[model samples]
Target: MPRKAAQVSEADKHAAEGGAVAVDRALFLLRAFRLGDTALTLAELAQRSGLYKSTLLRLLASLEHARLVVRHADGRYGLGPEVARLHAVYAASFSLETAVMPVLRQLVQDTRESAAFHVEQGEHRLCLYRVDSPQPVRDHARAGDLLPRNRGAGGRVLRAFAGARGQLYDTIRREGVATLVGDRVPDIAGVSAPVFGPGGELRGALTLTCPASRYRPDFRTDVLRAARALTETLGGSFPFDD
Candidate 1:
């Protein structure tokens, strides 16, 4: 679950940063442009950034010189070509494993259980990446193994986000997670949460599994945290939060 953020102004945060206050404030101004905003007038920028026009103009001048922001003939500001170049470079260099492995490894360490990333493959779910528990006893699943979509916590998460309807699926949808004992295999329990990629797509499910007798309900938090971290890394947002 997401914790409530303490009320803090951007100016306050910039001040709290002992060094590079100007740089932080300039970045904050850039962030004032939201999705669907093509261009912002000086007054609009001021309204959004809560900064004085003098400060903004000076920052905007520096940003324009760096090709990070552009001013139109109408005196409106828009993101510049350099931003696209940076995005292209980032997108070209990104790797799925780089974004996912660390989260799964951390989840395993935190829960002391097996962790896996599962993706829907037609009528089945594929275990794309997995980290085994340190303990000797654990489920025998591995990376590249395909499991049924009709069973298991990971499959249920995929189905729930894919519009499956039922009481259990409804609960999973509401809670942003699914937990089941003996769902996929006898005496095996699992907790799973959905991970997303860019454009709000359901990328996969991050799951933790252990013997039913040893399963702890608190593992749900670990699963949720791992899922959220991976989702953010993939440039997707998880809407469920406290």
Candidate 2:
């Protein structure tokens, strides 16, 4: 089943109790721009993020100053040059595996599970890179593993965060994070979050995979933290608390 957006938000809010709030709201504003339009008026930006006009203006000004957003002559705003530069930095920084290898390594080291990166191409999420677990008995996923968008944890996370469909997209539009348990494989549980490119397009996803038995009561929190850390390290952002 396509997991309901309301249920996802409720669960996420309950899990984000002790994380970075400012970073969350800032990323929320960025994600809000993905709502049907590539550019937005200040009023539209404020409305989408549920922030006061004054607050949204201030945030926009800050982003503009940092070159993460660019204001048009007509008072509309779109993604800025700095985002392009950041994207270039990202592209030039590493090969696919090298780009996310640190995070994958960390995930495997910490959870003793498998970790991978997947990108959306047409109707499928293609595994582009992966890091194996140190344990001899770890679950394995290789490069080029193509799964449907609704099949597994990585797919669900990418789908929810991408906000591709209409109303379903709007509901999770401001929260750029997602999780799934057994949606893909019955006995395998995993979590994933979106990775954006310079143009704010869905470039791919970062996922941590583990056996269902290893998913403790606090597994969601652990995954969320790992996702947030990876985002920060990559100079990427998400619309939810770390």
Clashes of each: 0, 0
State how far residue 49 of model 2 sits from its true place (Å). 22
Q: Using alpha carbons, what is the TM-score of model 1?
A: 0.86
Instruction: Give the clashing pairs for model 2.
Output: none
Error of 1 at 199 (Å): 2.8
RMSD of each: 5.3, 10.8
Tens-digit lDDT track of model 1 for 1-242: 54443554465465644668788878888777777799999999877876767778999999999999999999999999998999999999999988889998999899889999999998999999999999998998999999999899999999999999999999999999999999999999999999987668899999999999889878988889888889989988887662
lDDT score of residue 117 within candidate 2: 85
Predicted structure 2: clash tally? 0
Could you give candidate 2's per-residue lDDT for residues 13-101 as a string of tens digits? Answer: 43346866555556677766653576888877766666656656777778888998888988899988987798688677666455577
**Cα lDDT computed for each candidate against the true fold:** 0.89, 0.68
Question: Model 2, stretches more than 4 Å misplaced?
Answer: 1-94, 164-177
